[model samples]
Target chain A: MNVMIEATKLTKVYQMGDEQVHALRGVSFAVQKKDFIAIMGPSGSGKSTMLHIIGCLDRPTAGELFIEGLNVQEAGGNKLAEIRNQKIGFVFQNFNLMAKATAVENVELPLIYAGIRKRERRQRALAALERVGLSDRIKHRPPELSGGQRQRVAIARAMVTEPAFILADEPTGALDTTTSGQILDLFAELNDEGNTVILITHDPTVAQRTHRIIELLDGRITRDSSRNGVGA
Target chain B: MNILETMRSALWSLQSNKLRSFLSMLGIIIGVAAVVGIVSVGLGAQSSVLDMVSALGSNLIMISPASTVARGGSVSGDAVDLFTVDLANHMQETVHNMSLVVPQVQGSGLLIYEGANLRATLVGTTPSYPEVTNYHVQTGRFLHELDVENATPVVILGSRIAENLFGQANPIGRELTYVVGDRRHSLTIIGVMESKGQVLMGNYDSQVYVPISYAMERILRTQTVSTLMAQAISAEAASTAVGDAEFLLYSRLGTTDGFNVTSQDEMLETMGDVAFTLQLMLAAIGGISLVVGGIGVMNIMLVSVSERTREIGTRKALGAKRRDLLMQFIVESLALSTSGGAIGMILGVLIAKAVSDFGGWATSIEGPALAIAFTFSALVGLVAGVYPAMQAAKLDPVLALSHE
Candidate 1:
């Protein structure tokens, strides 16, 4: 019950011609409440695969994944959708905001799925964008804004739902150093507000900001350690 | 989600690709329009026919002896037995709402007057002929009851015939000799009838009229009338007159199955049925055009679905249900068709009116025809939209999301 994400012997396989490629080789892990964990690994190391499975966007080939004490492996698409709607917020590396929609509209995407009324969704989306300090740029479309601004809009979109877990797959991967620092400070502020944050990054500097880091090499965790005090 | 929200979203999405959406709707528009226009034209034709039939006098009925035309020869029934003086008298007395009855005999003859001669139809009829039919005297006067009783050597010339023979001179009180079969009879023209105009049959003012007794005794040489003409009290009494006349004639003749009794009402009803059939045929023709239009819509919508893969993915990710997406597309198609149908209906009515006004025909634009055409067009849209909407709604969200 204390574990937020409990993966037991989770494995994912792919068919490559006549051979089976193992993405996750019976990997198991856990994270407690308010834990800010970073997942780090080289390319094709199954870090992104693990994040996809944990985000309920894909199912593991074999094993059980429990989040908030509920089994997710057998849940149907609708149930997974509901879980994704209410419990998880994802930020992709490429900042996948709808091209036609403005910043606030993108942030209101999850609330729209939650069946919130238009006026209220707009208000909440605006508040979340203000928290990321993009309040004046609500009407800006993804193309109209800089790469960093688009990423902040995506972060606001993730945070607007006020979900239990924030899943950032390299939130600052496309941002400059200055914009990366701003986004990292926003994520730290959200973690300070007692929201569980899970960031996956290849940059060690990005991983250093989290309370704990889990480093994987070739689909196996080579290091799992806390830094300063807090899950540290 | 509420319908309004769904519609708003649909409208927004449609607004994003105005040209594509409009093109997709083009099919429905053309289809609905074709249906409305064609049916209106058909209904107008039907109305005109009915009006012409009504103007011919509602109490009138045409009866001809049933003849069998064979490859070798033709067989004619005994005309005397079918239309007799006794039968005419009985029809006048027994048929309720009966006004008058006139026995008629007809043959082709030559009328000679003032050294001018023309081939014309010779009609031997009672003085009541003018009353039973709608023809009236335009010159001197019609043959009176005295003329028929006395079997006077007198005649009534139709306006056209009188003009040809007399050349604007007073045809009444003039002498004309009619040659029929092998004999010629000198007759005085006592009256000239006004022209009633020709309809489907032919010109009315091209015939000459004389007493039935004179035609039978002097020319035909047989005690048999070729036809009988009966007048009803009013147009509304036509059906009653037909029923009563049929019953009276059947009882008098002691038979019913071998004869066909018809009134102007029956003729008009037959014409109405024909007009309705024509209207249906026209509607079907229009429907073919609509179906082609629907195919156009389907083709365009397929393109739209393909082009909007990312949009569909976005909507699916936004939690749009399959039914919602289906409804959006269907509604869009319907709006297009209905709008087009309305415009087509106006165009059809205008076209029908123009024809009616120009040709002086008794034409009409039927309301029910317009309604049916519009509804049918909408149905076309619904049918056309189904496949494309399904294709759009069934797109996998992951695949759509990954699409550019």
Candidate 2:
């Protein structure tokens, strides 16, 4: 199995006023290539912290994190940013699209940061939007699109960089049940196309569709399950 | 991200808030406009003044009687008669580098030609007046040395005086009556000088010139000359000529308090210094407004940073480096100020043109001034954008993404 992300004994402590809050306490996990996994937990369960650590958005207070065989804990800020740019794709619950930019422009954002040339960036963005079934709405701004369509545009933006893994935080949390199903179908399709997908959600119905599940409670993993007993 | 990408993003963001961007740019616009306009007009005035000084004859020097009262001496008639044609001649013979020497006396008189009466400034000077004062005869001939020795009733009319008195007719060879206090002397117009335009001293085209001997012996009946005008052989020799004249005058008069000698170059230098100081003071005042405009830019950038905190976080999460965010905001502010500077430069040129057209002032728009002002506005933008950009760059991504 090719491990795309591996977090070992990760702990994160944040200072709140004069008190210390442990957001994560000695959590360990690994995500394999092309694996569709859902991290499930209720609020304050440190699921978000786990997602952040996996996305390379925040450093752990004590742990070793490896992204594609590169130790993220030893990476500098800029190096970590490069890792995020080249390896991890992030999808927020709110879509996080620039409201003023068209769908294609938003899709091209990561490629711009990746220092790709303009013509190639546009070509790849169009391909990504086509992949997300947003080819017809490529010129539309986020505000002009429906919630599901907006999430599709966000997905296009995420996958446009051809990153190793797509890290989605509550991808369908803000959508209606019908729209949520369609977005989940798109994610499954993307995962089937050989892109690793990590979905963070509190809803079991949302987690049940994935191939594997990692459940957290009070900053510790309680269950790690695989539908096909490959590496569970 | 590359600079071009950053600039595009910055421009897109600014376009989303058009009114706010323009309002923020207004301060810089006014500041740069004021600076460009004031400096250009001030330079015009300085150049005009310098032109008038140069028109006075670059190689010329003047010797005049100093006020005896300034030396704590009682008024004496002998002191008023100290400067004479004999002393002028003696200085001409003794001073090195002397080219031409002309003594002059000045008064106001009424002229009558064919019932057209006008008051004109009368300059009683020797034949060398044309060479010493740079006056050229446009018609006929200038005053001859014979006219001075014989005290003949011959006079040269200025362009404006000739036009006023004789209309379209030639004034040369025409007789005109000059009225002094209780005396009316008829003089023949020997020449008409070309127009020399208005100068600091007065209108050169509105004066009449006569032989020094004629005015002293016949009209004013005064033996004293008001000033002794001398030309140096070259502009570079003017200082030497001044020193030699002053030495000769002091030796003959037995004291330095009675007369003052000044070269045209010295007067030009003093006036140039005064003009430079005035320009500096004006530019400083304009600079204050630029600083205020920079502060305004800083204030708006801070607001922009706060307003776009979530956007910054999103870009960071999408792999924008700290340097990228910094460049974006800095480029936005620079775009704002540089555009304002460009508009201000055009406005300043328009202002100078308006002044030259309507205010009757000579105004010039200097290229270097525009370049400097534009560069300064850009510098102001850079300085103003630093703190806000640093703040944006230092934002904690998680906290910023969660910000409302």
Candidate 3:
């Protein structure tokens, strides 16, 4: 099996004026190709900090993190940005779409940052939108779309660059139960199509649907469960 | 991201807030328009003044008695009476590069012909006055040397005076009464001068010309000449002619204290300096407005950056580097000011045209002024953008994303 993400003793400390706040303490995890994993934790459990570090949006105060065999800790600011552009895709709870950009334009964001040519970038963006079952909403802006449809557009944007894995931080947090089910079904279908996915959530029901679940408490992993007992 | 993509996104954001963008650009527009319009008007006035001077006469020099007070000397009647017809003739004969010399005596009087009466300036001069001063005879002939020798009581009516007194009838061979104080003399109008229009000195078409001999002996009863008009062989030789004439006058009068010699080119140069200074002052006033406009731009850009904090965070999360965000914001401000400059240039040209058309003022738009105005506006945009762009680029993505 190919390991897409490898972490060793990741620790994060933030300064609150003169005092220090520990967000993560010696958290260790590994995700393999095509694995659907959910990081479950209550509020203040440091799950958001872990998501930020894994998505390369930030660096841990002390840790070794590797994405697709490249050391994330050794990368400079611009280099980390490049790594994120090529290897990691992010889906935020708020959809995080440019309010003014249409669905197709929003999906084209990663490709633009990757310096892809315009014609090819557009073609790939259109294909990504179609893959998310949003072929008809290509010209609609985020404000004009429903909660489920906007989340679909954001998922399409994340997948447009063909990154190694999708890092979703509470992707269904803003949706109602029915819409959240539909989004989870889409994520399941994407994962089944051979894309590794990391989902962060606090709901036990949401964690149960994934192949593996890692629960954290007070910045430390309290449980790791795998149905097949592979890499557990 | 590429620069084109950055610029495209910048333009889209500006379009989303059209009213704010246009409001920010208004300052730059007014500043550039004022600069272009005022400088053009100043240049037009300068050229017109130079044209009027050329029309007065070219390759000409004027020598006159300086006021005793100007030289910080006590006034003396003998020194004031130093200019005479003989002295003019002697200087003309002795000075090199001089083509013609005419002595002049001037006085204002009322003329009466038939029942028409009008006030007019009377000039006493020689036959060479027309040639030296660029005035030509329309009909009949100018004063002859024989007239001066005989001190004949004859005069030439200017075109306006002729029309005023004779009412289209031939003024030549007619008689008009010249009255000064209590004395009145009957003079024959031998000729009428062509219209030379108004010049820097005064209206040439409102004066009457007579022989210098008659003007001194019969009219004002004075022996002194008021001015000496000397013409050089060519425009390039006027300076040499002025120097030689000044030296001759100094030697003859035994001092250079009483009289001053000046060339037309020197007068043009002085006028040019005054025009240049006026233009610089006007441009400085315009520049102040541009600085104020730049501050307005800075203020608006800061507001825009704060308003779009979430967008910046989204782009950063999407892998946009720090420089990318900086470039986008800077490009937005640059577009605003450059477009304003373009519009201002068009407005300025229209203003110049309107002034020339209805205000009776000459206005010329110069290319360099337009270029400088545009370049300065662009520079203003760049300077104004830096601080706001830095603020936007330095935002922490996590904090920005969480911001309301």
Candidate 4:
């Protein structure tokens, strides 16, 4: 199906020391193949909560989440894990590469869980790094790399599994303005290569780069807009 | 996904916290070392004990009157029945695995020659005593059957007793005076026993031998023998010989009163039992330390999990199963404990060897004890790692990612 991730009236309630915090309230959306989308919101806007459900990291309290035509809420913990392994690729803003692993080793993480053999995982990780234009920096750790290079390494890791959708959670949150721009450009380039890219961020500048932006405010979607031409 | 990659990842994590990991493993190290070392020491004690017991002879069975504590203890039957005279005949007729049986009556006397005076234990027995008890005559000749029948006034002195009396003078055919109760009698030294060596029991070189008839009728003035030493044809038949002797004694006396049969094997077994009990106690003590060490691993693992919240989140995002996270942490803990146990075993062996070489306490580490100690340590690790690993696995991927 072209509809890679479809959510319907998703609700999430979290207990925080005798108080109920409504993280998400009946949020509904769908992401299609090759579609570049942004869920843009400030802190406490439930954007992260939404990404967690779509990434199969959390199940909805009162809704249905269909990832790759499979309902995640009905899936067991192990099945959800398998679905996440097979279908999701998350790129975090911190460039969450393992601190001790080299760029190539960081990229190999997903395949390692996917039960890919070592030699092929190495080959695929090398190809993924090459795709991110990090062929020369594949042996460097995240601590040794510049912000933009680290983001590229994270992107390489996200793309290593060749998943249908790329979930970018505040992909430029930890970078300088110039490095953020470079990372945004890399996202647009990856989209140009026909990977569905979901950018979760608060910055208008980042949302302007996606073809569609679903803006949320206090656990509910306030705006859903589509600007079909690729870059801002 | 696979064990190799999991272990590699675990290895990497442990390597990152080398000092902390090593410190955490110290408990296991000490625990395993103590267990292995104590076990070796116990086994060594057992061996030394076996040496002391078997020095009397391995295939030899000693029949005494209950109360004398040997290396081990009696096997099954009760005690005490005079198998004295007809004992040898019954044994030869019934037990086919017999070799020799020497009845012994013990007495003590003061010996004097020139300016030297020595207190000596006198053993009265037949000519078969040396063969059954592994003693040999170094010089002159042993007493014969004719000497026992004739109540010969000849005596065979132990090496030390002969040396004390004779100095550089030849003791053979020399006149020696022995005082019994207040009466003194003169006897001729026919032979001197070879130096068998000294033990905790007594020095064999200080004993003097006389024929049973000569000792009981003249010196001891009694007919009751103190103990009997019997030799089986082979080591395998030693137990059978004890059993046969016990059966014959039971059938003859209808009770075990006045007779106790002890085998070298039984005595060795008792020593072995003592070693086993000691090892068990050591293991329990060691296990407590290992448990404490396991707790140390758990404590460190908990800190690691809390510290690596974002890392856990990233792995979950990259599709790590609960079992994967569980496996990773478990493997890390297991690696810590096993490595610690190995180092501890080496240290324990070294300590044991040092004690054996320099401290005079024998220590021996067998392969089985080492294996058991190591496996127990690893099991401790596994148990200790569970809660921490489960805690890490249960972390919320979104919240963990948000953690600094």
Candidate 5:
């Protein structure tokens, strides 16, 4: 297995007036290529902070993180932005798709940041949307779509650039049971297609669907288990 | 980001709020219009004054007699001796820079020719009067030195007076009778003068001219000359001519200085100075209007920033630089002001032309003023855009991204 993400002694502390809130505390983790991993935690744990660090959306206060053999903290603003644009994709809990743009335009944003021409970006975005079973909603805005369909559009946006890792921070947190089930199936399908998927959630049932689960409590990982070939 | 893309985005954004954009540009429009209109008025007045000054002969000087201290009795040689025929003769002979001199006395009477009658001013002048002033005969012949030598019953009618008495027919060789101070005398019209338009005082072509000796003997019945007219060799030598004339008069008349001599250049300089000060005052007034317009732009841009906060957040998340955001707002402001300036310039020019055509005044639009107005409006836009751009640039993506 190729190690896609490697972090050592990752710690983050935020100041709240005279008090300090420790978001992460010297947590170490490694993720391999094509791995479907779930970070399970109770409320106020460091799961989201760890996920943010892995996605390079933030810098660690007292640790070093390497994504695909590049030191993220040493990277400059343009370099960090390039890594975020070309190597990582994000899916927020609330389906953070730009509501003003149509479904295809929302998917085409990463490609635009990559400086792709308009025609090619549209073609590639349409194909990505089709792969996510959203071909008929190409011209519809998010306000005109259902919750599951909007989540599919967000997934399409995350996969449009063919990034190495997809960071799903509570991807199904806002969906109902049926919609969450469909989204979990979509994640399984995406993971089977040789892409690394990191799902951050607090639900045990959601964690059980992945190949491996890491449970976090009080800003530390207490249990790590692999359910290899069990769901298969 | 490229300038073209930013400009396109700004234009598209502004198009989304047509009424707001128009309202923001209104300040710049009024400011530019005020600047252009005021400058046009000032320029028209300056040019009109220049025309009037040039119409008078450049080298001419006028001298008026002194006022007597006592009205009951006149002193021997000190009183009533400032202007005289002897003084005029002495100045002409002794003043080296002088070209010609004429003594004039004036009165008003009715002019009668055939059956037509018109009220007119009667002026008594020497044969050299036309040469001393700018007036000259345009038709027939002027009253020559021989005419004045013989006290000939000859007169030169102004163009307007000729037109009033002779209706299109030549007034030359016609007889015009003037009743001056109870004496009625018939004089032959020898010449018609060219038209000299009006000035600050009055029209120069409304008076009637006759030989000085004839007028003094036949009309006023006084030997004291009313005024002395002096002409210099050139415009630059007017002061020298005046000094020489004064010296000669003082030496011949044996009197101290009690007379006043005025030159066309002196009067023009004073008028130009006053005009320049007025232009400065008007420009300051226009600048105040522009400042008020700038405040309007600033206020509108602040509103735009507040309204577009979410949009700015999205752009920042998309990796737009601070300069990119600044450029968009700045371009919006410049577009507003430049468009307003263009409309204002056109309106100002049209207004100037309309005034000139309707009021029969010489009104012109100055090129430098138009350029200045445009530049000033652009500056105002830039100043107005600064606060808004700073506010837009400082928006934090974390908070803005989650903004509802």
Candidate 6:
């Protein structure tokens, strides 16, 4: 399998007035294509920071990070944004669908950022929503959709760009257990269809649903292992 | 991103928040409207005043005895006769570019024509009076130098005088009898002057004009003419004509206090200066409102950026360039301001039209003024949108995403 992401000693430090807060400390990991993986951690474990770096939403303070063989650590904000548009899809915890935009419009966001033409963007967005089993909810706004359906639209949005990987940060954080199960099932289905998926969550149940789980603690990696015969 | 796509998205954003957009545009609307309306009104007033002053004649100038002071600066020059027929004749002969110089003597008389009696002004002027004042005879000949030389008892009746006395009958060759002082004099009517209703001086249409010789020698017997009407060759030559008249009058009278030479150009310039000042003051007032509107736009846009922090983060994570979010917010504000400006333009025009049609005020609405107002509001939008757009663009995506 082609390695989609490689991070060697990634570190993130933020200055909170007089003291520095180390969100990520010398974190290292690799994500292969079509990999169904979970980064499991508590609140201050820096999984979100690692996800941000992998998603190309931010650069590491001190480290070497590569996505699709390009050194993302050296990329500027605009370049990283372009890289993200071309390579990474992000699903947020809150569904993160623009409340005013229709489901199809929300799903079309990444493709829009990728500079796709209007007709093609719409067609692909429709197909992505269909793939997520949300074909009928395309016209519904976030407020009009159920929690599971809104997350489905967010997945469709993340899927529309055909990126190297889908990075979901606590994707089921706001949903109930049944909705969360449905969203995880959709993610598994997407992975089965040959899309790489990355999940950042603290829930052990969600972590066990993936093929591999990487646990982080105090901004450092604690464990990286694969479990056979899991739901991929 | 394509500009068209960005604009469409901006439009959608604004559409989703209708009330806030309109309330934000209110300041701009009122500002552009006030500016356009005031300028239209001022321009109309200026044009009307210019027209009224020009109706006398564009290159026309009037020479009158200046007001003089005695003791406490009270005007006491009513008894002074500062001008004579000779000075007028000299100016007419030697004045450069002077088309016509007509000396005039004013008097009041009672006319009796076939039992129709009316009290009217009697003007004694040279044959050149018609040329100087642009008063052309409608039906008959104007006063001639031969009639003046002969001191003939002939008169040119004003159109109103002819209309009142002869009804529809031709008054040329009709004998008109008039009482100048205590004696009744009969004169042959030669022509009727064209109707020039009421001018600044008085109603010329109700007067009668006779040769200077006949009016002065036979009627009022005045040798000193109080007023002189001079027509310059063109608007450009009026100053030269005035200079000539002033030089001659000053040389003869030996005192500048005796007479005043005033041109329509001078009156027009003075009135125009006053109008300009009024327009500038109005523009300042209008500009204040527009600035207030701009500030209002800035205030709302800043608030909008703050409220949409999460959305900005979403866009950023979705691979949107910082410029995308910046452009989105900026275009939204621009649309708000320009739309407000357009509506303000319409409102201003309506207000101006209402004032002119209903309030009986004059107002001129020019296309360029509307363009100016429209463009200015768009500029205000651009300037006002800058800070908010920068704030949005500068937002950290990680922090923004964390914003509830």
User: Which segments of model 2 are wrong by more than 4 Å?
Assistant: A227-231, B67-81, B180-185, B217-223, B252-258
Q: Taking the tens digit of each residue's C-alpha lDDT, what string does model 4 give over A81-103? A: 78877787888877888989899
C-alpha displacement of A152 in model 5, angstroms? 7.6
* Residue B193 displacement in candidate 6 (angstroms): 5.1
TM-score, chain A, candidate 3: 0.98
For all candidates in order, the CA lDDT equals 0.76, 0.89, 0.89, 0.86, 0.80, 0.88
Report clash pairs, candidate 2. Answer: none
Worst 10 residues of 1 chain A by lDDT: A223-232
| Interface RMSD of candidate number 6 | 0.9
The residue-by-residue lDDT of candidate 2 on B1-404, one tens digit each, is: 89999999888988988999888888888888988998899999999998998888659898888766633575544435778999888878877688888899988989998768999999898888888888789998888989998989999999999988787887778898999988999999999998998866788899999988998888888889888889999988999998898887777667777788889888889889999899889888877888898899899999999998888888988999999989998999998888878888888888888998999998878999999888989999999998999999999888887788
Better of 4 and 6 by TM-score: 6
TM-score of 1: 0.75
Regarding TM-score, does 2 or 4 come out ahead? Answer: 2
Q: What's the best-to-worst order under TM-score?
A: 2, 3, 6, 4, 5, 1
Residue-by-residue lDDT tens digits, candidate 6, B1-404:
77788899999999999999999999999999999999999999888777667667658988888766665765566425656777678788898778878888888899998879989898888888877776789988888889889988888888899999998988899897889779888989999888987665677799898888788887898767878888998889999888888887778666666688988889889889999999989977988899899999999999999999999998998888988888888898899999999999999999999999999988999988888888889999999999999999999998999998
- Interface RMSD after interface superposition, each candidate: 3.0, 0.7, 1.0, 1.0, 3.3, 0.9
Q: The CA-based lDDT of model 1 is what?
A: 0.76
Reference contact recovery of candidate 5 = 0.04
Which residue ranges in model 4 land beyond 4 Å of their true spot?
Answer: A15-20, A228-232, B58-61, B65-126, B145-189, B194-200, B203-206, B210-226, B230-269, B359-365
Q: Residues B42-122, candidate 4, lDDT per residue (tens digit)?
A: 888878777787788648888776653334665432333353545665576677777887788888889887677889998
- The TM-score values for the models, in the order shown, are 0.75, 0.94, 0.92, 0.81, 0.76, 0.86
Please tell me how candidate 6 rates in CAPRI terms.
medium
* B-chain TM-score, candidate 2: 0.93
lDDT of 2 by residue, A1-232 (tens): 4999888999999899999989889988888899999999999999988888888989999999998999999998899789889998999999888999999999999999999999999999999999988889999999999999999999988998989899999999999999999999999999999999999999999998899999999999999999787645
Give the DockQ (C-alpha) for candidate 1.
0.22
Kindly report which residue stretches of model 5 are placed more than 4 angstroms away from their true locations once superposed. A1-12, A24-60, A65-70, A75-232, B58-88, B102-124, B132-134, B146-155, B164-166, B173-188, B199-201, B212-229, B235-269
lDDT of model 3 at residue B47?
Answer: 93
